[model samples]
Target: MNKSRNWPVAVIVLLAIGLAGMAYQHFKFGEERKDFERRWNLTAAQLHNLSIVSDVPSDINFIPAKEGSGYVQLSGKLKSEIVRKLSQTEPASDGLQLDLSSDSFSIFSFDFRSTKSQITVALPEGLELGRFQLDLKSGGGSVRGVRAGQADLKTSSGRLVVSDVKAAQINLHSSSGKITAEQLEGTLTAATSSGGMSLTRISGDGTYTLSSGHLNGTGITGHVAIQTSSGDVTLSQFSGSGQIASSSGSITLSGQRSDSLNITARSGNVKLSKDDAFRGIYNLRTSSGSIHAPDSPGQTHDVIEVRTRSGNITIR
Candidate 1:
């Protein structure tokens, strides 16, 4: 009888161990699911209407001109502090195209304002393909894939990114945070107070200005202008005549051929290098740094005038 009672107790103990093991596995599974949702949360505010374009036209994509006008506004103020999750999704692989090349249309206008929640905005494919506008006011937000004829972007303390844009005029200004653009065309103007600006594969005639941050560009043509109070300026393969100024940093121009080049620095060095000779009047000055430019080994015709307060000028 004692052995029989002991048997019952042993069975009870084994059952308890199994229950504990199952509970541990359940806890771990829940934790993994939580992490998976966190990284894939890409949410935004988007607008699409059928009335704007009764039938998604093949030749003419986007909204018709006479259809109408509308706006997208986001309040972003939440009532309760609930932990809501989000999941991100990407577009399908099969892309659409336009059959007719002669016709173009302006799709929509986006106006975004945010208060509390963070936002990421995505645009439709090749929209406007011509004329578009974006007006953003918020504590913080991000934008991607925007095209327009004329664009005006201003942010107080938020980050902005614009890519693959074809426009006649583009304007961007930000107080703090970084701005980067790639494959941008036409006349462009960008300004930032405490943030850096970087451009790559840019093709157009444009002007750029910056303060308290770095300004960098590659593969840029046309008239260019850059000024920085306390940052470095770097340009590569920059063609056309332009002016560059820096209050307290180095200025470097490489693989550059220009008609006229002017460089001024309060206390920094200036370096210019070119494989071929360029015809122009060069004015370079520095308060307490050296200026160096090696002349072409072959025949050349150019005028270089340099002045320094307490620095040396070296021409090779």
Candidate 2:
């Protein structure tokens, strides 16, 4: 029994030695990695305009910082030294500039196959900026409880999310990413190419456009104009009127009131609530699909005009 135990101990020691040797070789080849982080503070009241541009795929988050304690925090774990050096914040005379580009080469700018960074921009709590802008090549950006005079947030192929944001004029654009916003007030303009949109409790005049994704919203109280191509438009609790158009998708709306609404669809269905309590002339027409409505078309000031090619029209 003693001899057997000695052999087992020897085998264990040998295995441990082999593992140590492999780890040593791997480390000796410079395969080690180190993360880089930077944090700084600035006066929020001194700055008004903010611009952030990133070329890599990064998660950019904005939060309300402490009073008079605004800061910009950037961190990344990258292999290239140039990328680590380029990721920094510069305080300008009027505002601040943040560039989070890993590779300075503009040829493969949007190729997000290499490194990703996380950025945190902490603004002063309850301090609104004069203007806000973020242009990301291939990343996602999110913010909550922030106010700006005008905000223009765009991403080439990533998501944009905002909550409880109040801006006088807001523009959100995404090429191949989704846009999700809630509790927004003022003039809003949103567009997406292949990504959808989800909005809730928005109180403003808005214009939305989508290429091949869905547009869904609720509790909207504004004169809104919506257009989509090969995507669906679904809204509820809407209390304003403008126009809604779709090419090859459905339009479903449940509203409390409307002044004058115009809806046009190429080959999709239209559904509305019969209990909308609006005395309007519903000019509903379709080429082949059926129509179920509570009122017929007549000359009136309040006109709910609906036209489709080959889809059912239901106002019940």
Candidate 3:
């Protein structure tokens, strides 16, 4: 009977030890979480360019500052160790470079599952940025209300959104991600692989190249070039010259006025729509498909050439 009583006591002791251990772990995790929840503020001299490199899931925002001042406001949850390391890094002469990757946490050996962290930056309005570039390996983000001389945004595999941007030169590249931009001005160059691209209300010379993705845009006023393979191309309300080429995908173009229109396709259909004010010489050709031209070739100064290997051509 005494031995039986001892067994009960031992079991009770073991239960208590397990409860204590669980409580300790819980408390430690809570403390670590609190550390990550803290916000960090940093100020620098007049910045002309900005570069950000992150390899984790993050959200970044660029807000136009109401007050005309050069300042960076960073707020988000990150590893305490990462915050510590960032505090030690020095900013470049022209801007700041942040590399927030798992490699950054290699120096710390604390055994804990890392939580997702995000860092957001807000810039002052009318700051006159010379260059704004972002290189993200994974995750998604957005940029808004940016006014710069040049901007370049690149991502490996995530959705990217940009709006209300006025730049002299804009370059966007994505390996496998969707890109959407609106109210963009100046010269724009966009390239994507296996991801769709959408541009709206653009007023500048633009060039878009895509492989296995769709390209769609509207309200364009300038020269434009589009090249795609296995993806469809569509444009509406275009008021300039355009050259489009595709393979295994259809092309649709509706223009207000165009001085020169050239389209080539392989195994895909080509469709064109124009206003009544359009007067151009039509040169339509197809191998294994029907051809529909708006008008016969004449002495008109403007030219619309359409060529297809195994697809139909329709013009109206």
Candidate 4:
């Protein structure tokens, strides 16, 4: 009888131990999901500009709100301690600024560390903005459906994407990250140190400069000027004039409408497509490579010049 009673107690003790072990494991390795949301009712007439500054890794998305007055919504997942410090906003006479720095003692001390966080911001739709600026240090982000008078986007080491932007002027600068923009209707000025750039369906003039990456564009409506140090260039379906230069990469252009086309390459091939609608005076020359301009149109006032130091030129 003692053994039987002891067996029951022993079984109970074993079960308790197992339960405790399971609880400990769950506490140590279970997922932690923390989220926070904040909303700001902004006066659209008073607020003309919006700026976002961050130092941590974040993915920012901007969507047009359907209802209500102009407002700003910020929602993200981060540590509770970090979330407490995210409430940094300043309203000036001209615009609203949101700074999401992860440094705790930023005012009185110096700390260059940032916690891992994901942030998303949504802006009101149909609100006319005078200026929109996004300055990020090390996070990948995207901006969409923004209609501003002027937009400037800069990032240090993350990819940047902009789409459906309607601005009078748009400037994008990136260091060590790729940049992509589509459906843009403005004068674009883009520069990158170590990343490729791609633009599509652009409606205005553009000036692109790259140090060590490719430049690609399609369906451009206005004048375009491209300069690359060590990367290739490819343009298709261009409707305006163009001036392209490359140091150590090939250049290829295919279009049927242009007032003038000029290309200069140092050590790469240059190719152009000619059609029945092409009307320009051909000036193709190369120092050490062959020059083939088979379909040079009848003499015209417009000029199509292609020059290369040590690469072939083909006009087909």
Please give the TM-score that candidate 2 achieves against the real structure. 0.78
Worst 10 residues of 3 by lDDT: 33-42
Q: How high is the CA lDDT of each candidate model?
A: 0.53, 0.79, 0.74, 0.78
Candidate 2 segments whose C-alpha is farther than 4 A from its true place: 1-34, 44-46, 57-69, 78-88, 104-118, 296-300
- The residue-by-residue lDDT of candidate 2 on 1-316, one tens digit each, is 5687699889999999977876766523332334768775667654587777876556666677865588767776544543455454457766777766444344422322335677777777677778888887776767665578998888897888878878999999999999999999989999999899999999999999999899999998989999999899999988888899999899999864775789999989999876445665888889989999886434446788889998999987
TM-score on alpha carbons, each prediction: 0.56, 0.78, 0.79, 0.80
Give Cα distance to truth, residue 260, candidate 4, Å: 0.5
Report the number of backbone clashes for model 4. Answer: 0
State the lDDT of candidate 1 residue by residue for 92-124, as single tens digits. Answer: 122111111112233421112222332222234
Residue 150 Cα positional deviation in candidate 2, in Å, after optimal superposition: 0.9
Query: Considering TM-score, where higher is better, how would the candidates rank from best to worst?
Result: 4, 3, 2, 1
Write the residue-wise lDDT of candidate 3 on 117-236 in tens digits. 445455665455788887877775677766678988888988888777788999988898998989888899999987999989988999999987998888988998999987999888
Candidate 1 wrongly placed segments (more than 4 Å): 1-131, 138-142, 277-291, 295-316
User: Per-residue lDDT of 267-302 in model 4, one digit per residue for the tens?
Assistant: 999988775576667888899999887655656788
Predicted structure with the largest TM-score when compared to the true one: 4
Cα error, residue 258 of model 3, in Å, equals 1.5
The segments of candidate 3 whose C-alpha lies over 4 angstroms from its true place after superposition are 1-45, 104-126, 296-299
In candidate 1, what residue range of length 10 has the lowest lDDT sum?
49-58
